[model samples]
Structure formats: structure tokens, C-alpha cells
Target: MNTLYPVMLEPQEPSGYCVQFVDIPGAITEGETLEECLFNAAEALTGVIESYIELGQEIPRPSENIKEAYYIAPDARVQSALLIRWARGDRSLADIARALETSWPSAQRLENPHHSPTLKQLERAASVLGKKLVLSLE
Candidate 1:
């Protein structure tokens, strides 16, 4: 799934730009320049995603058909966590653990935003989840 969230940028009074994710309410930020605004938007998006994970809430998928919207992605760690959770779908953590031949905690850590799972570990998890781990430079 594409992880880039579409955001609307509104010019603030006298200076800067305010950014809000189209599909994620409460994830907003502003900065003094377009570059800074984009940077802060990424941070804001990551924070909101982490909060969603902590609250056991489903993270909203990125909208594909938004017009005149700029796209931004969360930090790599958050993106990895979200991808793992989305790939797991209705499958239990135990199910993933069994497929990976690992303990439940280890498999659970793969989806932890705070815990950095190795690339090999992520690749293995993706394989088990019927996904291919593909990385690209933006």
C-alpha cells in the first residue's frame, strides 16, 4: 500500500504555511517556510500514527484521489510499523509468530513503532504476510 498521505497547505497570516493531512484529523502543523512546513508535517504525521498505535486505534489509510494535495510520508520507523500492521490484517500476532517461527513478543515487536526491527526481520515478516519489502529513495 502507498504510505504517502495527502495534505492541504494553507498560507498563514503574514507568513508560513499550515499543513493538515486530508485523511488524518488532528495531525496538523505550521512552519515559517514551505520546506520547514513539509518537515514539520512529517513529524506531526508520525506523532499522530504513534498515538493511534498506542491507543489501539486503526490508522487511516492514505487517500488516493485527493486533488491539489501535497503528499508526505511519516518517518521510516512509523511507516514500517504501519505497514506490518496493515499487512497482518485480521491475522493474530501469534499467527505471524508461528509463520516466522518466533515468539509472540518478537513478532509483536515488528509492529512496535518505538522498536526498530532489522531490515532482514522486516523482509521476512513481509514475505510471510505475502508482501514484498521494497524500498525507494524519494
Candidate 2:
């Protein structure tokens, strides 16, 4: 389940770009430069995901409306989380739960895209998968 959402970048006034995710309405931001806009978009997307998870709301499934829209990759948090789950592969969820010192259902919840995972949890999962979760800003 790729969470890369389609983003519509609308130029505003003389020199700024306003970006909005098609599937997750209200997740939008503007920046004076393309680089800044992407950085802010990543922040906005992560906030939206965290809010939905906190409120116990389901994060809407991404639409196929990317026809003419540019895609924004999921934020670092999401990327790391998904990576941990994907790396789990043939490994059992129960095994993951045992590794995380949690229950099976809780482990499954970690794999849920709508649920935002804590950095510590992600690192633990990555460690269990024999992978290292690294983050760098550029």
C-alpha cells in the first residue's frame, strides 16, 4: 500500500507555490520556493496523519486522481514505518509483536498506515528486521 499522495501545486500571486493533497483535503501549505514548499508539504502531511491517528479517525485511502498531479512521497515517519513492515515480509506478525514487547493485535496496528508510529517503536521494529532506520535533512 503506497501512501504517496497526489499533490496539486498551484502557483500563487507573483512567486509562491501552494500545494494540496488530493485525497486528504485540508492538508495544504505554501512556500516561496519549490524546495521550501516540498519541505512544508512533508510537515503538513505528517501533521494530518498524526491528527487522524490521535483522533482515531481513518486516514482516507489515496485516490487514483494522480492523472495530472505530481506525487509527494510519504514523510520520513511514514516511509520508515512502512519500511519496517515491508521488511517484515514472511516474518510473522506474532514474531514482530514479541520483538516489540506487545500483543499481536498491537503489532498489526503498527502496520496500519492510518496509525502513526513513535520513533522509538520504529527503531525497535527496524532493529528486529535487521535494518537501521536513519534520518537526514537535506
Candidate 3:
């Protein structure tokens, strides 16, 4: 499932915008324009959640009435794929590893945000988990 994070954007004094995510503490960024703010917001949110996933911490649910919602994209070849797949309760690391054509340790590392995986490998793992990985540029 795709996770949507709510962000609060405030115009900074003089210039730029300060972006803060409600559910993701320590996730803050700034941009000179709305476009840039939106882009940075995605990056910040992704980074926060990816860190949480990497640390095996909880991913917070979105709060109510979030005006600006950002999509979570911690890179398709990163831990987000493994987190999503595991969250589905459809398979174990061993099962996903076999489908990914890699070792179990590699499969486990696929869930580590600090460890990058090949996009092809993430795609294969997503397929095995019955998910279609969608990636886009802002």
C-alpha cells in the first residue's frame, strides 16, 4: 500500500517556505518556491520514514485534516519495498529472498534504508509480494 504523509508548510520570514511533517518528527526542510517546497517535502518525509523503517521503528499514521499530503518514496530499490511487502503479511524474508534470487541476508538488507538494493531486485520482490512499484519524479 502507498503511504501518504501530511505536511505543514509555512512561509518563512523574508523568503522561502519551512516544511514540516506532522507524523514525522525531525523531518523539516525549506524551499524558495512552492515547487521547491513540494519537492523538498517529499524528500524529507521519505527520509524520515525510511530511517524509521531502517531502525525497525513504527511508521506513524497520518493525522486528520492534512492540507498538503505527500507520497512516500524512499526509492523503489530501498527499504520501502521490503517494508511494504512485510507489512502485507504475505511472505517471510526467506520466501522473498528466493523470489529475489538473493541470499536471505541480502533480502533482509533490502529492508534496510542504509543499504541500497538494485531497482530490478526491488521490482522482483514487489512482484513476488503482489505489488506494483510505482516511481515518479516531482
Candidate 4:
């Protein structure tokens, strides 16, 4: 599934725009222009997700009903980390480690947003999780 979150871009006083994420509470940001606002929104979204991971909280899934709403995606590393964690579901990291024939720490690193896992590592993890790793540009 494409991991694009919907955001509401509201015009602010005097000129700029304020962006609020539809699914994530408190994940809000503002910019002096539409371009800058959307850019800031991406950073805000990534930060929120990173915070969630650090707190061991479940990351909110992107809403699909995006009619008339602007959408944004977090950076690739955050996206990859979230995707792996979400796909792992109830399975243990140790299970994935065993299937990948790697140590637990290595498999665990796949879910660390700060650690950039190689494409091969991500693909193998997805395969073991019975999911496919899909990448996109935009």
C-alpha cells in the first residue's frame, strides 16, 4: 500500500498556510508559502513517526479517504521502517531474523528509521514477512 498521509492546508493570517495531518494529532506545521508548507509537513510527519517508534507506540496508518485533501509522504527511511514494522504485525523480530539467517540485532535494525537498511535487506525482510517491498518516486 502507498503510505501517503492526507493533510489539510488551511490559509493563515496575512498570507501563509498551515498544514494539519488528518490521521495524526499534533502533527502540524506552517510555512509562508504552499511549497514550503508541504515541505514542512513532510518533516513534521517523519518526526511524529520517529517519536512513535521511540515510544513503542503504533504508528497511525494513512487514511484512504483523501478527497480534496493534500497528501504527503515521509522520507524514504521513515517509510521503510514503518512499512517493515507494520508488515511484521504480530510476528517477533527473532522470527524474521531466523528466516533471514541473520542475527536479531541486524533484523531489528530494519525497523530503525535512523538506520538505512540496504535495498537487499529490505527486500529479504519483506519476502520473509510474506509482503513485497515496493518503492516509488514522487
**Each prediction's number of clashing residue pairs:** 0, 0, 0, 0
TM-score of each: 0.97, 0.60, 0.67, 0.96
Residue by residue across 1-138, what tens digits does model 2's lDDT show? 456778888999988998999988979999998788887887888778766655656566667666778667666656554565567878999999998898998787676666678878877887888888776553
The full ranking of all candidates by TM-score, starting with the best, is: 1, 4, 3, 2
What is the TM-score of candidate 1?
Answer: 0.97
After TM-score superposition, the amount by which residue 41's alpha carbon in candidate 2 deviates from its true location, in angstroms, is 0.9
Per-residue alpha-carbon lDDT of candidate 4 for residues 62-107, written as tens digits (9 for 90 to 100) = 9987787889998898899999999999999999999999999999
Question: For model 2, what is the alpha-carbon lDDT of residue 31?
Answer: 93
Q: How far out, in Å, is residue 7 in model 3?
A: 1.6
What is the RMSD of candidate 1?
A: 0.8
Cα-based lDDT for every prediction: 0.93, 0.75, 0.69, 0.91
The digit string of per-residue lDDT tens for model 3 on 1-138 reads 545567777888899988888777888999999889878877777677777776767676657665555444445444464455456474688977787788989888767766776777667767877877676564
lDDT of 2 at 39: 78
lDDT, model 1, position 9: 93
